[model samples]
Target chain A: MKNKKMAPIGVFDSGVGGLTVAREISRQLPYENIVYFGDTARVPYGSKSQNTIIRFSEQIIRFLRTKQVKAIVIACNTASALALDAVKDEFDLPIIGVVIPGARAAVEATTNGKVGVVGTEATVQSGMYTKVIQGMNPKIEVIEKACPLFVPLVEEGFKEHIVTREIIEYYLESMRNTDIDAMILGCTHYPLLRSKIREYMGDKIQIVNPAYETAMDLKRLLEEEEMANDETTEHHSEYSFYVSDAAEKFRKFANTVMPFDVPTTNVVNIEEY
Target chain B: MKNKKMAPIGVFDSGVGGLTVAREISRQLPYENIVYFGDTARVPYGSKSQNTIIRFSEQIIRFLRTKQVKAIVIACNTASALALDAVKDEFDLPIIGVVIPGARAAVEATTNGKVGVVGTEATVQSGMYTKVIQGMNPKIEVIEKACPLFVPLVEEGFKEHIVTREIIEYYLESMRNTDIDAMILGCTHYPLLRSKIREYMGDKIQIVNPAYETAMDLKRLLEEEEMANDETTEHHSEYSFYVSDAAEKFRKFANTVMPFDVPTTNVVNIEEY
Candidate 1:
């Protein structure tokens, strides 16, 4: 219900995975309204072409802009890697992506020079994390792997299953073989499988969730722009959930995984935008 | 070049998995001109809603109809399960789907009356195979499980990897525990993982690939209707490949897993049709 120009922050991802980013935003900025959109119909942007990813992101951003949100977050790693640059200049508002913030966090978290990043095929292939990390600190050793199966594994609610652990081992084999002190859970969905990934990678390897870092980045930008919601005025945070398709399915998923209660969700025909 | 009314069979799937069905048709009817379309852009229709899947199937069917395809095969199991009935009457052509043929094959192959089926979530939920099989023989029992990760696993080309075998064990544990003598690889993408599935299920269970059955079903319809392309003529069979996106990627995949060579491929903006 908070429609004041500075009251809402727009968050969007290819699918429900974006909720992780939104969850962090809610935790960090409780009084800020969140307008979240999930492209559920054509999700798993990890395997899609860059053009399609950009097209979808632009459509979602267009839809979000109509809501008069103060700023936007590209919550998905694949979308951040492939579509962020393309949509950045076009959208008139302040927009932040997960890639740079995540890279910065990984750089800060690592003790040893060895760092690891795992994400969808498109995100890993984009090399955004490696480029940003190595650019920030030239001596850091970056190990990257594309864990394309992680989304499906998490979506299937197999996060703690032995199957997931084996899969984690399978995907993290290259990362595990190294002496990486910090690992970035590059994809938004990867955070859901953090327990299995941690169990497989062992406690020595620090796990970094970019959703947390992206939320922190949003908080900083909001404060700098003087848009932070005044939390002391007895104003409660409001959440709006939208999906391209399968509203009920998204609602069920959100209710289970999200920290806040998801009472209802609406469907948006994202293509029209 | 075989556009002479009834010279070509239109075959389509969500993506390359339908290539398995295309491969089967190519193997069974070596002389039939095959027009294959892969909806690579909006692929893995397996997890999508019925309405979306039906809409996608109709678009692809309309596209294939333009090529003068006499008979059309819905190679993708999810589309065939959810969309075939919706599109069958409107299309004015002899349309065949994989579900019925697959059910028939499973019924014939089952000795213990307990038949197992593995497919994407949507296909399993549709229960088309169960309905068709039970309608044919009421005495038989059907045990169905949705293996949502199998598509991603195969798409990642981890068909024979230890991870795949372990994941297969995770999914098929229910079926493997049953007295089911035969199992249907209900999703077209599945045949690519045949060896691993067979290895996991052991040699006792008869593995039924619906693509092969669907191909045989098409063979029957073509012969019955006198639409079979004559091989004895100076005509050599021609194969044309089209995808909604990623022509080069589809070409590469077809070249690797197809029964024949894939020299070239074309991209189609399926939405425009």
Candidate 2:
């Protein structure tokens, strides 16, 4: 149990988008060490097929196992949608994905029982959010939208720009008409555009940030399984970052999204795993 | 020489974006067969480093060699910008990139000696177009802009949509004021947004589709090298398509961009090469 508590938690995404999840996890569980892997070389996994996403996720998981992670967080919504189930049992560690946690949050948050989901094309197409939300309560209506431009907009660093606002409005126009009391930001990158999305959706509608909820979920799971790191230790926890390409670029982007400084980042040839 | 004339010309882009280039090549060189590979599994080489792009391009070139291509066209602007020079000497065939042809055409078309170049972030950052254009004529001024959203807009099939127009105007607003007489669509996907871009820039600015110019350049090179396919063969030229993932998606996109029929597209595990 002591050794298990000291092991780092593995978190991964197709790219830096998953840093949002990592940030949230660190905020929620400050004592836990984290090892994050971003497959920057073959990013935007939302456009990829289920088989490819699964294969890539499997490879990433295999790589993370070498780091001796006590648990794994599939921080990417596309990978969570397509690859999570297939890989959940393959590894002995606790494997949690963003989909179920976000869905659970939406189910609990929705006052009108009409929930909206916004994510990449692949995630929306997977219908994982809809399945989980409906499974929780069949009466709840799920509206899934694929906002393909949102990710590009965020990557371009257009968070508060008028163009980003216009795009958000354009994507969420239909969802606004429906009485969706809660909206799940199904993509990790979507949280970066939170203000614009909230402005467009109005204050009445709850914005569900899966990263935050997933972090909370991870905290609960760790506590339940006695995997939480011992806070009694005087040593500070470390967070290590790895990407497939452009470590400098990833570091720059990481600084923008992450609250704490990322002192060093290593580039891993993800194909090797 | 006779056998060389029968061999297909190889063209490749990181993904289906190069279908725009393939369509132009087919239009210009009707008698020449084309073997096109879209590295769909690991695409958008724009964000990757020069070394990785060169490596991926080398792998693709090796695969194309197996198809007995007489010449090769690096249709991806990012690849042409970063990987072309590195791989040119590695192959015996006449290797062409969209940059030189596009730069040549821009130089020819720009009466005011001011040319605007738009492409992916990496291509624009590489300064390949600016260097090539300025090298031809030192007095010519080059303004390069990275329109990152354009590709996602086109992929979402928003070519003529108002959102696309707004985004284009937003991206090109600075270039429009610079008194440039021409703009090079440095990325193959940009050609699809030609009409909207033209409307934004007005009638005076010539929109250079590098794909078309590259095709013309290929035609000129084949003639110069005496490798033009003999039309007397009394056989129709065949165009074969290959992608690393989602053959059906690539086929659907090819149908939309390609004038002729693409009956089938094979999936290649590019890593194998």
Candidate 3:
């Protein structure tokens, strides 16, 4: 508990999209310190190949290891889908990914056994969610759709815009006929459009946000492994944000999405790693 | 002429977006051989920093140099805006960028001495068009708007979708009341949405595509420097496409946008350069 309390937990993503996950972790575990890295220089890892994604994830993991993190979270779904297997065994720390927790959540929440997943092209192509959910329960059916435009729409700050609704409808048109009792927001950016997605999918469908479940899973793991910070420290937990490019721009964007003020944002020369 | 005829003209962009420029170049200079490199692995250069952009441009330039190109065209707006000056003097060859040519055309086409420029956030933020336009003709009024979402919208193949129309209208809402007679499609991707943009802006507004002008500029430069392939050869002019990631994906996307069939597409290890 003492060693874990002092060592910060690392979180990383392709860009500011993973802040949603980090935000949840901060809320769920107030005592834990967080060290976050966003690969803002080369973002939207969803479009890149598996080799590139793995290379990038390894670099970020190596950087985080230098920060002395007790645990690491691959906050980007694309990275988790494509890079988890390559890095999970290499590191000594408990490394968690968004796919498994999200898949488990969808499996638990689905009453009709039919669950839907929407993510980037790479995430959908990797079929990580479907694979994990099917592994958890062989009978559960997974319907995965690649929502390529959602990330851009979200980045453009069109979460509640009318065009966003239209795009959502267009992407989810096929799912309308299919009976999906629970839908998993497979991408970190998708959670921002929760209301619009919910509005489009109707009241009966449950939108499962993996970020929430991921935070819960981390909490459970920490407790189980006796890594939970049981000490009541006088100092407030700190959050450090690092990005590969334009720290100020990332800081400004983070302020808009994050509930708390981002005070310590720095630029990291990721290539050196 | 014989020496230049054998040496292919080089063109590069951050991703498939630059295929628009390559398409125009192929149309305007059908006889000239072309070598195009798309940095698909680290695309959307508009979001990256100036230093990183310059580094990428230099690497691509080095790679193109190995191909023995007579001249190089910076097909990407962001790269032209950020890296052109840095690399132009470093290399002995005559290098051209899209910004200057587009600005020149905009200034020439405008009757009201008022021009509008729509591009990526980084391109618009760089103020390259405004600077070049004002440098060419100080009397010409340049109104610059960063249409950040256009690239993603185009990549998502929403060029003719209703939501795309809505998005175009939303982005151009501020420009609707302006007295600008000419608007520069500053980014290569913007030209793909030319018809939709023209429809939204009405017939009175002349859309100035930089890719067209850039190709023309390259043609003129080749002629002026006696680098034109004046010698008629029996062999057909070849086109080679290289991407930092998935060559097949780039080839497929290029087929949809390009008029000619892309015959030789290969993957490049850009970082090694």
Highest TM-score: give the candidate number. Answer: 2
**Candidate order (lDDT):** 2, 3, 1
User: What does TM-score give for chain A of every model?
Assistant: 0.96, 0.97, 0.97
| Predicted complexes: DockQ each | 0.59, 0.71, 0.74
Superposed model 1: Cα runs more than 4 Å off: A1-7, B1-7, B224-226
What lDDT does each candidate get?
A: 0.87, 0.91, 0.90
CAPRI-style quality class for the chain A–B interface of candidate 3: medium
* Per-residue lDDT over A1-273 for candidate 2, one digit per residue giving the tens place of the 0 to 100 score: 789899999999999989999999989999999999999989989998998999899889999999999999999999999999999867777999999999999999998889999999999999999999999999999999999989888887777677777777778899999999999999998888888888888999999999988999999999999999986569698899998888999998899878888878898877778
Q: Compute each candidate's TM-score over C-alphas.
A: 0.93, 0.96, 0.95
Q: Which is superior by TM-score, 2 or 3?
A: 2
Report the error of model 3 at residue A249, Å. 1.7
| Alpha carbon deviation, residue B71, candidate 3 (Å) | 2.1
Candidate 2 chain A lDDT trough over 10 residues, lowest sum: A157-166
lDDT by residue for model 3 (A1-273), tens: 588666888999999989999999989998888999999988989888998899889989999999999999999999999999889988888999999999999999999999999999999999889999999999999999999999988887788789988999899999977999999999999988888888889999989999999999999988888887765569588789999988888999899877789876999878678
TM-score of chain B of each: 0.95, 0.97, 0.96
DockQ of 1: 0.59
What shift in Å separates residue B185 of candidate 1 from its native position after superposition? 1.3
**Global local distance difference test of model 3:** 0.90
DockQ of 2: 0.71
Against the true structure, whose DockQ is highest? 3
